[model samples]
Target: MIIRTRAGALATTAVLAVTGGLLTATPAAAASVCSSPKWRVQFYANTTLSGTPKATFCESALNQNYGLGDPPGVTLPKDNFSARWTLTRDFGSGGPFTFTAESQDGVRVYVDGVRKIDAWRNVTATQRRTLNLSLPAGSHTIRVDFAAWTGAANVKFTYAPRTASTVDKVRPLAPTGPSVSYDRTVNRATLLWLRNKEMDIAGYRVYRRPATSTAWSRVSGTGLVTSDTYANLPPATGETYLYEVRAVDKAGNESTGSADRSVVSVDRTRPASPTGLTGADARGGVTLRWTAVPDAARYTVFRQKRPVNGEIQPVVEAATVTSPTWTDTTAPERADYTYSVSAVDAAGNASVRSADLTVTRGDHPPAPPTGVTTADSRYGVHLQWSGSTSDDVAGYRLYRDGELAVDRIDRAVDDTTRPYTFAYEDRNARYGTTYEYVVAAVDRSGNETRAAAVTHTTPGDRVPPAVVTGLTATPREDGVLLEWEPNQEPDLKRYDVYKATWLGDGPIGSEDGAWAIGQIAWLNETDTSYLHKATPEGETVLYAVVATDDWGNSRAPHTGQEFAWVTVTELGTPTEG
Candidate 1:
């Protein structure tokens, strides 16, 4: 049960009592009156304290005790006695107040003759009863009845408010007419809100929260800003911001927030152009690489194509990526191709195209490497392929389930003309999982032969993987680098890394907090770390990991006891690969 009372210091409990018999006669009026606001007291016979009082007088306060003794004036029974006290006064405006009444035998209180509290009962100890009342403006009568059938006789009455003040009773209404206008030329946003109509309002305060963030912050530094208009706010570029205003009264009561307004500040400045564009003509595709561009959200590749016999056009868009490397697998065989890259900011502003790089495919492409095979064991998938027999052959590239699993073969060969054996272990492949594999043979002149595909299904392994630990994330200019202690489970296939844009109090897939966007990257069982090079700058990124067994069973990162989590702010300098 909730009890609401006026604001004031808490008061101590009151105790009172009366009994079966009272003094038989009245006492002479004391020479001195019972102070200013005294209480009219009366004593009566019978345990119910019914009929009229056998003795009458006035007391300055309720603090009273009548031990084993006769009445000072008239004679009356001592053991069983009853008494009643009445006080009347005019209290101001209606408000929450507390009324406390105590007694040794029994006691009850009445406001304006209406029962407000009742604790009447026979007892060896003093009993106390407190009642909170909302008194109206006017004169009211307060009466307390007490009885003492045995033992000690005592009675006390007191009351006080509960809260420090009644200001909380009033709340300012929400602000209206909220609006935001952004000036692109001046690069500032002006906010306007209707002034609160509350008479006691001290001032207004503005709050701002970034569109991508869940936290809110006060925008004003000075206390109680009285202005209804906030001008010249330079919000962050390339982001949308939310704003609201709240009114605070002089009594320190704050009203609900006003309707929110949102504004988008587009970043019009272009990013630095990517440099060092170079292309290598290889079998089946062209491989391109470039130096990283600072503050570039992503790199857009443009291919220079000749639609007519003589006219050259560089309008053909290729691909976009945070990584600096890209492979064009659709380049026509034995054809010349020119490519260039341009940096794009988050606001879609593009920089000038980098220098052009041209590469001509060789006339004779390398022969397709034959005899591709895979061995699926409980550990992982083991792949083997035959080297190309052409003299211009460079090395092989491997693909898993049609995805570029390995960009290039790691083994070094002294001669390209002779057929040789190439091997790779796909330790990250889970057991009980079927996978398709393909290998391509490329030559020095950027010529290539189509590779034959191979399929293999791993044997099932039921052992669960161990939880990953030592997770650490390092911020970089281009992205976030994550590393963790490798799992020791022999059947561990690979590690799946998950990222969350926000961590506290959010909605996830079927969960209420820590929503995982998706798997950011996968790592081999032996690999301890991975790098993400395209995260947004000035934002914190949260990461978690899960280790999967050969049979596809997984162990998620421990969220308790020892939670494996890493946070990094996007502030790293570009470390181009």
Candidate 2:
């Protein structure tokens, strides 16, 4: 809503004056004039009398008869010359909208940068009109000049996009898809088909078929009427059935039939308990979550204002989704929405509505919660989420290997760290031994979700040692100079060198029930090379570095000691580091 100040009118005569008689030669491509519009009082002389008999509106509301010959005894209406235009076609967008008005004398239609009718002229009021206007989708501007021609005149113009839907084409009208419902009283079934885009869309048809048979029977009345509900459906009194629908246009154009909507027409009485119900304002959208029923084809989600009557609840937003979730961005702000959901069977019958849920949206995000999953023999089990974004999360907390570990924080996980990752070498368990794990996300709020459980077997942890660089074991004066190029991880926290007599023998960290042993002694500092104390007496001390990087991610064990060629001389008690 804006007010436009009237400048004046630019008649076709001005084009001749500016370009020196260039009547048809590209009138200097003036800017569109819809950008600026003017309003004025007008007179619609119904009765063809003499002087101004009555005025619908005038230049000014008070100046009823300033120029016309109307006296003070006559009352006049306010200036009624106003109109909002819609574009039929536009040259470009954004306007230097320039238009021209052609009136003999006493009238003018203001356009951009042009003025014609200075004073009244007695000449015939005839002028070829042209308007250059910037055309936007919705509202626009129009120009008209109908001054006192024989006592009165009529004001009229035409435009497009009379309604909001005419401009926004993405609006969805009726629900589409196979729908089924069941009835209880007669043990019958009812099918519903909806095909609607605009209020002008016609109606729908319902096709019925039994679960055991392949043939279908089309109900009466080619769906050309006003209603879509099909009555007296399959009277099997609790039989599963299938149904489908097609839409017909006003001109008798019938669209292809929709996919079948399957149903079971359960007890046809009360609906089964609705499950997986949850609510949240997620990722800038309102989401209602639910678990899907195994045999149901569609979940009927209903929304309405606070209940008003005693029997039926007012339904506002009724929509369906492929899965169990329904989203509504149209929910009003600061207002509560009551929702009820029902499962519709393949037999064209719907269960009674579930109890309503009142949901509200808040401004803040819910705190991060803890959860976990497991992958057999894989350190990383994968992480999933259910809560809101964190405002001050430094990183996350990973729990594994019988202990809690930190993976990432205010810092994001590098190519190295991951979620659901265990930080310990519990690989010693027998192949079928079950291992436990969990993960938790820590936010600036220090709040966390309950830890989730993950159970998996170690599958003998037999994956070959993953060495990044080369691996080699050389015999040296210090029993065995068991050295290896350390993993190049700056997050290298520490390294535990393992020594086993045989390549396939038990690892040095095997406990009572575990074959992996922790006896190999060269615990080298994370930053230095190592010469394991006096080579233990055998072809075994197969050295491998379990490098723990700085961020607490341990490099998978890599073997360096090729014990097949090296032999160690017995040392003092063969002490372990």
Residue 197 of model 1: what lDDT? 45
Off by over 4 Å in 2: 1-82, 85-180, 188-195, 198-202, 211-216, 235-239, 265-577
Models 1 onward score TM values of 0.27, 0.21
Candidate 2 lDDT over 1-577, as tens digits, reads 1111222222231232312221111122331222222233223322222243232222111112222222122222222221112222221112223344433224333323233323233334344343444334233333344443432212222222212332322222223654566656655556555445332244655567778889877764544446666664563435567776665433333455567766664434333646757777642346888766665667788887554454455686478655678776555434467777787766545656677787874333224443334444354333343322334333456565556654543333222433222222333345546656555555444545435666665443333322434445666546666555656543344665565453344554454223233446535445445566663454444455565443444334333322222234334444569
Supply the global lDDT for candidate 2: 0.45
Off by over 4 Å in 1: 1-171, 232-238, 269-286, 289-342, 350-577
Q: What is the C-alpha RMSD of each candidate to the true structure, in Å?
A: 38.4, 29.8
Top candidate, metric TM-score: 1
Task: Tell me the tens digit of each residue's lDDT in model 1 across 1-577.
Answer: 1111222212112112233442245445551234325787777665777886666666667766555443333344556767778877644223356788877778888889899888888888877787877666446778888887876667788754333345235455667899999987776778888776444467888888888998878887668778898864646466788888887765566677888898877677677888988888764467899998777888999886544567765568889888899987655555677788999877788999998888775566877888888886445887877776555677778888878888778484333544777888898897567888888887777666767788888778755566688888887756788888888887778888888775566533335656445677877888898888775557666787778876777755433323356776778444669
Model 1 lDDT on a 0 to 1 scale = 0.71
Backbone clashes per model, in order?
Answer: 30, 52
